[model samples]
Target: MSPASSHTHRPPALAGLELLASAVVLVDADGTISYANAAAENLLESSLKALSRQKLAAQFLNPEELDNICAQARLHKFSDLRQDLTLERAGRDPLHVHSIVSVLDEPAGHVLIELREHLQHIKLDREERILDQSQVNKELIRNLAHEIKNPLGGIRGAAQLLEMELPPLHLGQLREYTQVIIKEADRLQTLVDRLLAPHRRPHIVGDVNIHEVCERVRSLILAEFPAGLTILRDYDASIPEFRGDKEQLIQTVLNIAHNAAQALSARIEAGEAQLTFKTRVARQVTLAKVRYGLALDLHIIDNGPGISPQIRDRIFYPLVSGREGGSGLGLTLAQTFVQQHMGVIECESRPGYTDFRILLPLP
Candidate 1:
């Protein structure tokens, strides 16, 4: 049957299944898919129209398991049934899922399957662990910054005094050495201040329009790299204003954009660099141990050489940088600001593409 006719014949109750965050698929006793919802399409990484034309057993890594589940559901009748299964997709790695099987009573021989990827649980666990680590990092940074800050002022003062005491005639080169010490101290002081800035600043809360923030950052970036870079925006106008510190949000996005531009230096020189800011609404997202019904998904994607694998895992840590002469605090600050707003930031990178995804809870 054609996809249109196939969809029209699907049980009316299955319409509500599309609203669920978990992947839901309906199949006949013969293993042919009768219906697949949006979430199922996303998990399977294929359109419902395409998936409907295939068999459930063909899409699973262990086809026997799926066959048995369907057979058992049809024979003994089932509801709220649970199973662990693996899914197979073309050109992609197999995915482990927590599957729940049930018999749709209206469709006599139809079986309903709900699939939730184990990867989502892993990501949630990882995010929680990172949030815990961030707290520890902040504490350590505060203590270390204070310790270093105290000595830096004393060292700079001593260098200035020493320079003054040296004779102008014979010890001029010695004064230059003292000058170096003072200059180095100042640089260290600046670093210490930045390390403590997040803690020192007050979070000024207000309704923030995300698009305005993106526009501000885009204008600044274009002004800085007018010739070689293109800043593209794909925004969802339906996203509503949320409570946040607007300035902090702007800084957070700007920092990430600046780093992307810097990473695109080679592409920039060749005049092929592209940076895209895409915004969408994400539903049923968990951030920092709390589940949000709705959240803003802001993506900063760049087409450039990706992050170095050596430092990719540590990129969010303060003072960790993949590039030479980098202070390595931009991403750290971005993460800090996001966490302050009860949001999460994640990244995925390959050789030719890098995406920084920020999720902020919406009221």
Candidate 2:
């Protein structure tokens, strides 16, 4: 080695930069966290002893992900940009962090890194708004439906009673009028029930296995439409049980799947209809003005005729449907239930395949 090169050291001005910096983690090649800037300790919610020398992967969202990062660091020494990373910080919400790793010029095995918060928080603000809109819609339907219930019941009863009293000639005519009122009332009742179901019930949060939820939805859909479609499971078993209302989750997932099934009817007959339920862990997800260190990532993918350009943008809006016979409330209800659990759902649809991503915060 050249004499001047071997003697090079961290410039005096740069020595104290890391010591007083605002980054979350600092580590060496053995994956030991040798130093954590004050901001890092605060973000992780622990002190030096609890964090020092611990394997960086131990506190990460997925340990294997850290391994991948380390591998990247080893391969590309001058590549200063670290891709966004999610971390499961103890006693704090999941953090969506963007990071950078660079080779340390002096300390041979040292890698200097810095991280910043990412895209999870802004999403929660949108969810809060959706919840408000759903509540208003539910109240309007329930109150209005009640008004129709009383008068319609009286009209049907009076018609039947009159038919019994009047001579046989006019009895049939009165019965027909009553039948009209009864049919109309029943239809109105069904409409009211659909509107009120989501808001009328209390959320039952518990330890729910996401895979079971997927399996149940799969069975129900296949039973209803078996031949033309394929339902595949791509699950990450390490995903832990999260606190969620099982029935609500079932309906939430079911509505999306049902829509995909309908869209794929033609593809199914052609032996190309495909639906996949994929699960993984998302770290540092921000939803509903909150962050979780770990979140459930569920993807519902389908191969179909794709949504029409006209109504595609409004699919989740109440009363918007591309189908002639559809109520258009399925996706709306799905969005409400997911928002109740502080989850965010987004959709991407094109000519052949559509993807719905559900990100639920891990408990």
Candidate 3:
């Protein structure tokens, strides 16, 4: 038979697999791959044409186990089977995935396989938890700020009144004590205002160029750290302008980058610090349980001592900080502003590497 005549055509029913986020593959009774979806192609790091040319069992390190599973499904022993397997790649790290095998009714010997990366599942779970926790943190902060604000004002007012009512003879000595009380109250009031700032400010909307925001932040950071740190830009110019608050977006990026720079102080002094601002367009992204066709994938990466494990999970919560003397409100406010634009921020950190990723929907 001619090469053209021997080429296998994919069944129309399999086209819908492309819409799914999970990787999917279809194999014949002989264990030959007949179809691979977009997600599958990406996971396998090969095109459908190439993947189809190879046996499905060859993709995994343990081929006999996969063949046996396919055989069981083909024999009608079980309608479905689930297992965790590791996929071997040519030049990349092995991918651990949870695979589900289902026997197709129409195709006598065909089996459908679905794959979900274990890390992706963990990431999705973490994102959901962060979203839920963020809501609770905001409520707690707002209520706590208001409660503290009322008592703070009263304390400051009473201190001032007592300072004024002090006798002229003892005023000099007594005034110092009242002044300390007044100053501490003022400081607490400032903290409360910052805590409530995100909730009080109106979101100003406009067409924002993410690169411009990055540039502004870059200039600011460089101005502060001139000698030791290196800030690299890896921006995709094809990203279109999106509707968002330019100032808020700037603040979001600034707060993240600034924290990274501060964390790099030790490395900065040694002249080996590095920070990277990366931007890309993410397709078929799901943020806060809502899927979007396109989204902004922004990363603020730094090489520094990683965030402490004790507070890593609570970094976005108000008053949580990894650094000594850190007010801990920077990341909290950053999360709040991003949420206002229907976006999400996620962090992954380990010794020598920390990545803060921000995902925002695009039009």
Question: For model 1, how does the per-residue alpha-carbon lDDT over 200-256 read when each residue is reduced to its tens digit?
Answer: 999999999999999999999999999889999999999999999999999999999
Q: Pick out the ten consecutive residues of candidate 2 with the lowest summed lDDT.
A: 3-12
Q: Which stretches of candidate 1 lie over 4 Å from their true place?
A: 1-21, 25-98, 107-110
Better of 1 and 2 by lDDT: 1
Instruction: Compute the lDDT of residue 264 as modeled in candidate 3.
Output: 97
lDDT of 3 by residue, 1-363 (tens): 554333345567777777788889998778888788777876776667787777988989877888888889888889899988889975335788888998998677889999889899677788889888889999999998999999888899999999989999999999999999999998898899999988888989999999999999999999999999999999999999999999999999999999999999999999999999989876657788887867898989999998999999889988888999999999999999999999999888888889999999999
Which stretches of candidate 2 lie above 4 Å from their native place?
1-129, 142-167
lDDT, model 1: 0.88
lDDT of 2 by residue, 156-268 (tens): 67756765787777877677776776677677667767777887899898899999999999999999988978999999899999888999999999999999999898898
**Clash tally, candidates in order:** 0, 7, 0
Candidate 3 clash pair list: none
What would the TM-scores of all predictions be? 0.82, 0.66, 0.79
Least accurate 10 contiguous residues by lDDT in model 1: 2-11
How far does residue 102 in candidate 1 sit from its true spot (Å)?
2.8
The candidate that achieves the highest TM-score relative to the unseen native structure: 1
| Candidate 2 TM-score versus the reference | 0.66
